[model samples]
Target: MGTFTHGATEWDVACPRRPSRVAGLTMAGFRVRDLDPLRMVPHPAVTLLLEFGAGSTVLDCAAGRQERGSIVAGPGLGTGGAVRARGVNVECVQVRLSPVIARAVLGASPADLDGAAVPLGDLWGREASRLREQLGDVPSWQDRFALTEALLARRCAAGPPVDPEVAWAWHRIAVSRGLARVDGLAAEVGWSRKRLWSRFRSQLGLPPKSAVKLVRFDHAAHRLVAGEAAARVAADTGYADQSHLHRDVMAFTGATPVALAAEPFLAVDDLAWPGHGTPGRPHVPAGQRPVRGPESAQPPH
Candidate 1:
């Protein structure tokens, strides 16, 4: 366990002693005594929030919809800044599943989420409640992580996988930090543009271009949190200009780069996930961090 403090927000965060045996599966446990209302930032993985504690977890979503307890959201859950999270004495085990494996582990297509949060029960039925109970009963964070991984491995083993080409495209985008020329990737994989786009969206939840923008924004947003200048981040991450970067940030988060720089939601990632910004194992070559910086701003977001 470690303490992650960003501005006035603090959380007792835990990381598994080792990465999960399952590929694309990573777990982080968080216990926040007084979780302030934090804005949701877009991320490129399917997020599973399994809450278990004496207090409650609340998500305030767009159109005044609210969801409590466990939630599963597809990639870019907060596009247009539609979600906010707050809770008291909230303890949860958060899992980030790679899109390639999300369908298998989630037992539902990421496309169904459409980037919005849904109650876990809607997908997992009573097992969601049972899992919540089991998590609360667990004595240690490591135990909870092990239990969670076992469930994920079982589901992933039994569930269907995304097409190899689609998975390949997603990984290419990810390791390139969303700067990959997705347009060319289709040809590289011997698929036409239309076929690739439809398949990627149906299985993974978003179109290739949208995925690229979201991934790029995720990388740039974290750099902003790291106190890098907007202009510098833009240049480094493949935006046409600082204004372009600003627009992408505002589009995804509804916040200017300046305001997002101070957000604790992103700051916690540094401590919780640490070395990598996202939940899965590091995808970048050692020298390419920001956890895989893109090669150039070509096909700029």
Candidate 2:
């Protein structure tokens, strides 16, 4: 766990040392003593927030929707720049699920969420309450992680898996950091362009083109957060020019590149998600065995 003080609030954030037993899942823990509004940023993964704290965390959406307690947010949240969170004495376990495996683990299709955060209780019924109780009863962060993993493993086992073609296409997009062409993906998957677009959007909550743009934007955003110049980042990340990168940054975050570079949400990713994109995982071509582990896992929502 790392300790940091922002203004008057003290925060402790922890990431699990052990990778999740279930493929396509990653977990982190957070405890906050003072309340501060956390600016939620858009990412590619579906997020599950499980709270075991004494006080509930409140999520305010740009569309005027609000939610409290444990919640689940789908991919591309905060694209409208309306999503923010605040809590007092908050303790929670957050899981990021690959859209490929999200249906299995979350028991709902990502398309249903439409980039909104919903209370977990609404999706899982009593199970959400039970999970909070179970997590709160645990004494150590490892234990909480283990329990959460076990629950996800069980749910994944019982839920439906994504189509192998869809999974392969998603992996390709992720490995390429969203630079892969949709037409190339269609060819690789042996599906017609129309078919691939429809299926990808229906299953993953976004069309193939949107996925590429979002993934590419995420990569560029992080590079900016790492202090890279906009022009350099654009050149390296496949953006046509600095202005194109700026437009994308504004479209996704409603903030300039410089302002987004200093966002706490993106800054904390290094500490919260170390060894994020592990290398050495050979790329399996479309229709091959599905890749496993965090390398193939989706990004945070």
Q: Whose TM-score is greatest here?
A: 1
lDDT of 1 by residue, 1-301 (tens): 9998866777999999987788787789999999988899988889999999788999999999999999999999988888999999999999988888899888999999999999999999999999999999989999999999999899988998777667767777887887889788776556678998999999999999998898889899999999999999999999999999999999999999999998887988877787768432323211211111233222221
Q: Candidate 1 at 169: error in angstroms? A: 0.6
Q: How many pairs of residues collide in each model?
A: 0, 1
- TM, every model: 0.92, 0.91
Q: What's the TM for model 2?
A: 0.91
Clashing pairs in 2: 62-82
True-structure lDDT of candidate 2 = 0.81
Instruction: Give the lDDT of residue 120 in candidate 2.
Output: 94
Residue runs of model 2 more than 4 Å from their true location after superposition: 277-301
Q: What is the lDDT of residue 86 in candidate 1?
A: 95
Model 2, 223-298: lDDT tens digits are 8989999999999999999999999998888889998998877877777777662211223223434333324533
